[model samples]
Target: MQRKKIAVIGIGSFGKLFVQYLFEDGHEVIAIDKDPVIIDSIKDSVTIAVALDATDEHALISQGIADVDYAVIALADDFETSIICAESLKKCGVKNIYARYQTPLQMKVLELLGIKDLFNPEERAARSMAETFSFSGMRSSFLLSDDYSVVEVTVPKRYINKTIAEADLRHKYNINVITIKRPITNKESKRASDSKGEKILGIPHGNTLLREDDVVVLFGSQSDITRFLES
Candidate 1:
């Protein structure tokens, strides 16, 4: 997927996950919130995490929010502030925008700004929420334990061009490569020419070869997965 620049205004529970999932998708995400503590919590996961008033147009412009491909405003309880932020985003020339609203009036205000993409806050369970985000390599996460997580990650450079049998992920990293998401290729005696889409190569066998662009869905402890990806 192409990397997009996105500005997310608000750092509450839902907004934090939105930023995390976007970042995990390999997008350049700018996380904006007024609370310093909230900003600090999310700083490591985003391209930029700033504690600033989103309603301030000058501040938004200075942060280059206008140049981002999209912006999401999700001030959970503050519909008025969200409204102001929408206007500020408009002034900054951000075209593609999405917002969350609590009430009917909040929806109407956002709709008036040409923001048709609005979502209502839904009550979600923890595990279900994680599962929802995990599909894009886990915008949601598959947390088997506090120590273990089933994660989808790109193939390490060292593993590229090697067969799964040779890489020995199971032995070396203690991680199971359950499947591989690879670019759809035309059949020419296994000639992998790029198509415009990707498909999951179900149940990779020992002979399955790894590619530079392959995203491997693996299951393991968090520490082991970290080691696998980092090394």
Candidate 2:
């Protein structure tokens, strides 16, 4: 993969983690924050750390923000500042821009400014955690729309030895399995004994029966998932 340059504005907890992940993934990162202390804390971790107000378009451009492949604004406390930074980044010709907003009104303002991706980390985390309580065996779920969700659920022991056709998953639960995560041997192994080693021995095949420990990734309506779980 081609290494990409990324610029992150507001070195708050969220922004700091995001930049760190980008850098760890082999991307060049430019960290910007109004607080000099915050920039200094992450100076060694990032390619460059700048202490400048992201709301100031000229100052951001001067700090090489315009040359980045992607820009992220994660100023949670100041919505206006986040919007200003987003707009400034857009005007600077940054191709990919991401911003965080707290409320619906703030989201609307960001949308009006032509910001395509707006995230609310708190809300997202809450929603994800809520799914575990609502559905038994659910590890995570994503709301695609008001009526639809993509969910991950562990196949119960009762469902073992049932074929896709026999289970009638679509007709009974209105859920579609998109993919199965079958574990493969690690390619980095050097020894033949290591290659032959039974590391958590199991085979995942489409025609093979589902097991108690197998995780199923399904996509369907929330109502369908609820009803399926109830049955």
Best by TM-score: 2
lDDT of 2: 0.80
- Model 1, runs deviating above 4 Å: 123-231
Give the best candidate by lDDT: 1
Return the TM-score for each candidate structure: 0.55, 0.77
Tens digits of lDDT, candidate 2, 32-142: 898999999999899999999888889987977778888988888988788777778878888899888898899899889888787888887788688878778887888
Instruction: Quote model 2's TM-score.
Output: 0.77
Residue-level lDDT for 72 in candidate 1 = 93
- Model 2 scores worst on lDDT over the 10 consecutive residues at 196-205
Q: For model 1, what is the error of residue 157's alpha carbon versus the real structure, in angstroms, after optimal superposition?
A: 44
